[model samples]
Target chain A: MTGQSTVLAADVPFPPSVEDFYLPSIVPWGGHDSYWFTKITALLWISVALIIIFFLVTYRKPKLVPTKKQWIAESIYGFVRNNIAVDMLGKRGINFAPYLTTLFVFILIMNFWAIVPFAQISPNSHIAFPAVLAVISYVMFIYIGMKHHGGLKYFKHALIPPAPWFILPLLIPIEFFSTFIVRPFSLAVRLFANMFAGHMLLLVFTLGGFAMLNANVWFAPFSVVSWAMTIALTFLEFLVICLQAYVFTVLTASYVQGALADEH
Target chain B: MGMTAVAYLIAGMLVWGGIGLLVDHWVGTKGIFAGIGAVVGIGGGVYLIVRRLGA
Candidate 1:
């Protein structure tokens, strides 16, 4: 430790460090504790409210001709409904469009918050949000499986699969652990890791660019190049934001489909 | 999606292997149970992934 000489870093503007990619808190309290109105928390609430407002404004009055706002809303709904739900679940998916659509849009908006001006960090970059979403999906599929297949039968179908009875014992634990435990855990980890990585990449290029600006006169031009990379990555983040949302929604639909199906 | 499969596979091994270690402690055995648990976990994980995700 450079002791007294060491500087206050990243989250501060004066000197940039890689740690700037994380450890910023708009709220004074611990996130795991009560009274945590951190930046991520606010963004999560705002994302939900904005999405509600978006839909309300667009479809407040149904129009035959359709205004531009209505068209945008319809397209978003149709895209998720047709492309994700219907495509994965077939005709059986028609009833699920609303649920899947809302899930898709919510995840998209929360993730896209990372690139927004004042809200440069995504809430899903944190593990808790993803975990909650994943758990909801897990419980949903489990409920569907149980309801459709019957209580004991659902466990039988899930644990035994279509395999022969001789090997059922070995497969039971594997299936139980993977389906019950791993599904939600992996779902959460996947979303959290992607958002976390994307944010880090942006922080790296943007802050590195600014820091390089004063590294030396000769290195100053490279700072511009770094800033350019940051801009490029921002656009990439847009694709990632949409893609992750779509992927999550599709997987959830697929899980539902699997539960309803006669066989795996 | 591919990464999820990988995570599942790795998670299975770690999770089951931990269980095996606990069992080993309870039974006062060596690493035998843990090794078997790990291999079984890996095999089961790969089998499930391929069945679910393979085209």
Candidate 2:
């Protein structure tokens, strides 16, 4: 009674707060201040844990006749083996199928987190994640190249391609720059920047709706339109998510193939 | 971005690239070109940073 207002308040305004909108981290670890970090990291780890658990459980008891889970696992394995490895790297590439498949599925799951509710962030949107992945692929390919060809031969193959001598100066430097520097950087940055910008755009529209809702009674109706756009964008993000993952895996296979081949 | 931030970013990228090159070499791949590329990236990064900061 003592704390009662002098006049009864009917329309209590919701104070503008920072909590409602999501702002992506521009640098790695920048999001630790917000829910974005916890949500995205937890979801990513959970995806990894689930993949491991699924494979372990499904393959723990192998059989000549497959169970439902076994069939699903085999299908996924075969899909990458046949489609990505064999198609890109040829028959010898079958051996790389498992690693490439793991990379694809893991990245796909991380990318999918962008569209998932509550989490609403892609881990790969952070440059560090993609950079780490690119490094792994870079290392793998280099290892494969050396393992296949001898020490000096790999360098000779990578730089000195089967081309005319006149173009050697231009091509060698260009090839060298592209294969070593541009390839991995572009691989990482492309995925990170795309996902990051996509998520940021989604955030802007979605939060704009909420911000508008607080403006006036007339503004309330426009929120639905904003939401509709958000939904459409969400669908587009899904396509991008899958496409980026595929591109990453495909590029990895191609790099490995290039490394293994006699010709550059 | 601030000059320091730009500098740090360039340095980080170069260091990472160098690390990548060294790893490739250690793994037994002929990574001489890769190492050169890393050095070039570092130089490019420094040049870009210098130009931006100078402006």
Q: Tens digits of per-residue lDDT for model 2 on A20-67?
A: 234455345565655445555677789999899999999999899999
- Superposed by TM-score, candidate 1 places the C-alpha of residue B43 at a distance from the truth, in angstroms, of 3.6
User: What are the DockQ scores of the candidates, in order?
Assistant: 0.34, 0.03
Model 1 C-alpha lDDT per residue in residues A206-236, reported as the tens digit of each score: 7777566655567767878988999999999
Candidate of highest lDDT: 1
lDDT of each: 0.80, 0.73
Candidate 1 segments whose C-alpha is farther than 4 A from its true place: A1-35, B1-39, B45-55
Q: Counting only residues 3 or more apart in sequence or on different chains, how many pairs clash (N, Cα, C under 3 Å) in candidate 2?
A: 0
Candidate 2 segments whose C-alpha is farther than 4 A from its true place: A1-37, A216-218, B1-55
Point to the candidate with the largest DockQ: 1
Please provide TM-scores computed only on chain A for all of the candidate models, following their numbering. 0.86, 0.82
lDDT of 1 by residue, B1-55 (tens): 5654875587668767878899999999998889898988787677767665676
- Model 1 has an lDDT value of 0.80
